[model samples]
Target: MNALGLVVEYNPFHNGHFYHLAESKKETNADVVIAVMSGNFLQRGEPALISKWERTKMALHCGIDLVIELPYAFATQKANTFANGAVSILEALKCQSLCFGSELGEISSFLGANEFLHKSKQQYDELIKKQIKTGVSYPTALTNAFQELTNGKEILDLSLPNNILGFHYVKSIREQQAQMKPFTIQRTSAGYHEQNFVSPTIASATSIRKSIFSNEGDITNYVPSVTFQILNEYKMEKGLLHNWEQYFHLLKYSIMTMTEEDLLTIYEVEEGLENRIKKNILHAQSFQDFMERIKTKRYTWTRLQRLCTHILTKTTKQQMSFINDSQTAPYIRLLGMSSKGQEYLRSIKKQIELPIISKLATFRHPLLELDIKATNTYNMIFEEPLRSKLLKAEYATPPIRL
Candidate 1:
C-alpha cells in the first residue's frame, strides 16, 4: 500500500510523461500515485493548452491514482512559489517518495548543486547581484556565479524547462524539511523544448500540442490511447485562451489608473521594475508587447508574466509577504481521486495536518476565497462555451478506466 507523489502540470500529457509514471511505479513499487497539478493557468503565466479536467483525465488514464489542483496563486508564479505550493501538497498527501523526469537524471548532481546553493553566503549573494548589475539576465548571472565555485557544473538554470523545475523541487523539499524521498527518471526522445515527435512513446508535450492544433496527423502515436480517445470526444482549438484578448482594455485601464504605490503593490516588483512596467503600460499594445517593452536583464520572461498575473489577480505585495511568512499552505484542494485514493485519504485524514478541500461553496478563509475568485476570473477568459462549462466542472469523474 505504498504511495508515491508527483507534482506536474501535464498541460497535456504526452509520451515522455507516461514513461515517467511507469518508471516511478516500477522504481517505487507503489500502489498509488498522487499528483499536484496546475489548474487553468501554468507556471509560465500562459493558459493551459486545455482545461484542468482534461489534463486530470489524461493523468488518471495513464495510471495516476489521485490528482489535486495547484492553486492559481502558485501555479502562475515563479519557480520557488510554484514548487512551494506543489511540494506542500505532495508532503501533505503523505507520500513516501516523489519521482520526476529530469534531463541529467543524475540525482547526485542535483543534490550537489542544491547543497552549494544552500550554503551560499554573503559572498555568493553579492557576486550574483554584481553580475546581474552588469546587465546579464538573472539566469545567466546565477549560472556564471555558480560556475565560479563549481567550474560551471553545480548550478541548474531555469531557462531550460525540466532542470529548472527539478532544482525548485529539490530546494522546496529542503526548505520544508519534509520526509518524502526524491528520485528522477531521465528524459528520453524529444527534449522539453523539442518541437518534433519521433519517439514511439516519449514525445514532448510541445510536439503533441503542435500536432493537435494543426490537425496535421493523429496524435495517438505520441499519447496513450485513452488520452486520444478523450481528446477525440471534442474539438479543441489552439490557445483555448483566445478570449484573453478581451482583457486588453481592462489591463490598459488598470495600469493607467493605478498609482505608483499601486504598481509597487504587485508581487515580483523590485528595484523599480514597477516604474518600467507603468511606463510600458501606456505605450505597449498587448500583454506580450507590454512584457517585451519592460523586459530587463534582472527580470526573466516568466518572472514578468508572474508579475502581470499578480496584477491581473490584484494580488498585493502585502499579501505576498503574508503568504511567504506563513509556513504552510491553507488547504489541499482535491481535483479527482480513485477508490484506492479515497482509502488513502481516510488513512491519512487525521494524520494529515492541512485541511483537504473538495468543494468551494463553504470555503471561508480569505486566502482560500481568493483562490476561488481567481478561478472564476480565469473562467471568464475561456471561450463562451467553456466559460460555464469550466465553472460547473465537477470533480470525481469515474476513475480513469485504464
Candidate 2:
C-alpha cells in the first residue's frame, strides 16, 4: 500500500485545501494519505477559529486516510521547527511520499533553492547580521542579504507563504534523509494572507475568516461541503482572535509588570527587542498597533506575534533547548488512522526507528506533559470555558475510522 503524507493547519478546510489534498494523492498515486495537522493554534500565533476535531472530521470526510495532530508547541513555531515537527511525524508514519501546496508550483526549483540555502546559510547568516547591525530589520536584512548572494534570482520572492514553507519541508527532509518523495501542487488564485475575497470561487483562509467574522457574503464557494457541515453542526462561533484591543491590554500589563530580564527570557526576544517591546507596550492600543510599534524592518509582525505567544505561554530557554536537542522526532503519535494507514504502519512498524505513541497515559514524560498543556491552551481559545473543561481531552476523542 503506497501511502502519501501531508502537513497542514486546515485552519478551516476550504476548496483550495481540498484541491491540494486530492492532488497530493493523484500526484503520489497513493492509496492512503496521512496528514499531520495543527491542533488549535495556527502558525500565525492566532487561535484556530474552529476545533481540531471538527477540522479532523472535515479531513476524514473529504479525502484523508489518517489525521495526526501537530502539537500546539510546534504548530505555533517558526518555519524550521514547524516544518520539522510536521515532517518528522510524516516520516515516522513511514509514508512513501509527501506533498504540499506551492505558489511557484515548481517543486524542482524549491528543492534546488533548499540545497543552495543550506550550503550558503553560514555566509548568508553573516551578511544578514551585518545588514541588521546597520539598522535594517531582520526580515529585510535577510531578504537583502539573500538577494545579494542570489543576484536577486531565487530569494526575491520569499514572501509567498507556500514557497517559504515548501523550502522548510525540503530542508527538513534533506536534513533527516527521509525516504519520502516530495511533491508540490500549484496554489489556486487565492493568496494565503489575503483578507478580502477577490474572486467568487477562490479566497484565502484569512479572507474566509474575515467574511465569517463580519458575516459578509456567501462563503459556500470557497470551502468544501464537509467544512460547511461542521460549521453548522457545531454552531462554531467566529474569530477567537476577535478582540485585539483586549489582548493588547493583557500584553501591556504583562510587559509592564515583568522585568527586562523576564522579557529577555522569551523565545524570539533577541538583540534587545525587549527594550522595544517594553516601550511599545504602553503606546499601543490594538494588537496590530502594538506589532506596528515594535516592527522594525528586521522583525516582521508574524515574528513579533510568535514572540508574544511564547511570552504568554512562558516558554523558557530550557524548553527551547529541549526541543532542539530532541531534534529527531522520537515517535509517531497516531491521532486517527484508517485501515489502509494501519496496514502501512504494520508493514514498517519493525523497521521504524522511533516509538509510535497512541495512548498518552502509557508515556508519562515531560515532553508529553508539555504537549498536553499546549493542547489545553488551544482549547481555551476554542470556547471560553472549554479550555478548562478539555484537560486531558484526547482521552475522550476516539480514533477516527475511515
What is the number of backbone collisions in each predicted candidate, taken in the order shown?
0, 4
lDDT of 2 by residue, 1-402 (tens): 788999987868898888888888888899888899887667877666666777888887888878887765677787878998888888887888999898888688877877788899899888988888987755567567877878878542566778878888988999989889899998888888888888878788889888877888888998987787787776644334332343455567778899889888877788588888888788777887888788876677777787887766666666666677866455566667667767777777887776667777666655555566556644443444655456656666667766
**Which runs in model 1 stand beyond 4 Å of their true positions?**
153-159, 198-201, 211-218, 232-250, 256-260, 281-286, 382-402
Cα-lDDT of candidate 1: 0.74
TM-score of each: 0.86, 0.89
Q: Which digits, one per residue and each the tens of the lDDT, describe model 1 over residues 93-165?
A: 8888888788887677677778877887566788889888898877777667777756655355444668777
What does candidate 2 score on TM? 0.89
Off by over 4 Å in 2: 118-121, 154-156, 236-257, 282-285, 381-387
Clashing pairs in model 1, backbone N/Cα/C closer than 3 A: none
TM-score of candidate 1 on Cα atoms, chains taken together: 0.86
Give each model's whole-structure lDDT.
Answer: 0.74, 0.76
